[model samples]
Target: MLPRPSRLTLPSIARWARLNGSSSRAASGGVTLLPTQEPTPEANATLTEEEFSSMIIHGRSIYPPLYHPRTHSVPVAQLQFRAYQHQFLDLYMHFVGHAAAALGIPISRPVYLPTQRSLWTVPRGPFVHKKSQENFERKVHKRAIKAWDADPEVVDRWVRYITRHAMPGVGLRVTQWKRAPLGIGQQMVDSAVGQTRLGSGAVKVKALAEKIVQQELLVEENADTATR
Candidate 1:
């Protein structure tokens, strides 16, 4: 007779059953088993100091340094953003400031203007129920951003960027003060005359005016000759 197989304990049988079930589950593509060992110090030490120091998270460098340059000026233009919701307006302003800083623009602290409030009262019921009415109020929030000693082209690009990605329910307005050199009027006139084209009809009208003036002058000359 063959020797009886060694009897397995209940705990051993249960453990064996669990191992078989896990293996089957893994083979069936239901789950995967991963190693639980942590990275060893030797593996970590393989990385150079610079390589480890330059690591980035979410596309931003870790512990980036900031550079501040001394300046002595204010911006020539002011960008103002307004919205009925103060929270959104403030959030967008912070975003703008961040963008400006990234672009190396010297920005000043945001100036907050007085909030504008308007109230309206309307009847809640029929016209006969004049005593029953409801009141509604709205407030407008405004923020002003100033940049100092920034290039106009750069400022324009910044404005375009902000406008293109402007948040919903927010309105943007730009105010620029430009200094004109002497003889600006003459320069403008010269530019208009040089660049503008007169239509055929306009040319004809101008010729007709000159012809009329010439005819009037000739008539006066003929009258004076006749009198002589």
Candidate 2:
């Protein structure tokens, strides 16, 4: 079956109501009877003809427009201000990342935010085994290269460049990530950082490596029991 017509937008509904000399509410419920149009037999199936006619008349009584009136206009100046704020925050985060990389410090270490009176630390979890760790790192490398396939670098070069530049830059700037555009900034940084809990891909692989050793120990114990 064909889809029913979508509800008209507020502007269209208002225009139709005005042209018909009826309130918007009325325009919604009032169906105009064309010259050859007859009430459907189904209308009388539920009630007597007179009763059906009355029901038709009642259904035609359009309700008032459910117009949501905004109290104040959004100032264009405020919007422009917000845009500028976003740009500044983005640049600042970039600068932070570059600085952190130069210092050779892990960005995830709890750094005291003097102004905020709190320390900021990145998230840390999602441990796996050593064999799993190698697979995980390989997967990350493949995915990252594929994602940036449009860029002007081969996979090895891209990985090297990211290790020397992008990763550290991202780690450094994360402290300021929250100040950037909430939606866009968070997504970009998260993509760069992998999971927020673990600082970077390297950390995630290390955690997975530890789990793999534990699994090996369990397998050795099971083998000894079977031999005995």
RMSD of 1: 18.4
* List of clashing residue pairs for candidate 2: 25-63, 26-62, 123-197, 124-197, 128-208, 129-208, 129-212, 130-212
Candidate achieving the largest TM-score: 1
Backbone atom clashes (below 3 Å) for every candidate:
0, 8
What tens digits encode model 2's per-residue C-alpha lDDT throughout 16-128?
33345355346557654232343343433434322221222322213221112223322111000011233343443333333333322222212222221223443343444
Which ten-residue region of model 1 has the weakest summed lDDT? 57-66
Q: Least lDDT summed over 10 consecutive residues: which range in candidate 2?
A: 137-146
List runs of model 1 lying over 4 Å from the truth.
1-70, 178-228
Per-residue lDDT, model 2, residue 47, is 41
Cα lDDT, all candidates: 0.66, 0.33
* Native-referenced Cα lDDT, model 1: 0.66
lDDT of 1 by residue, 144-189 (tens): 9777777778788878898898999999999875556899999888
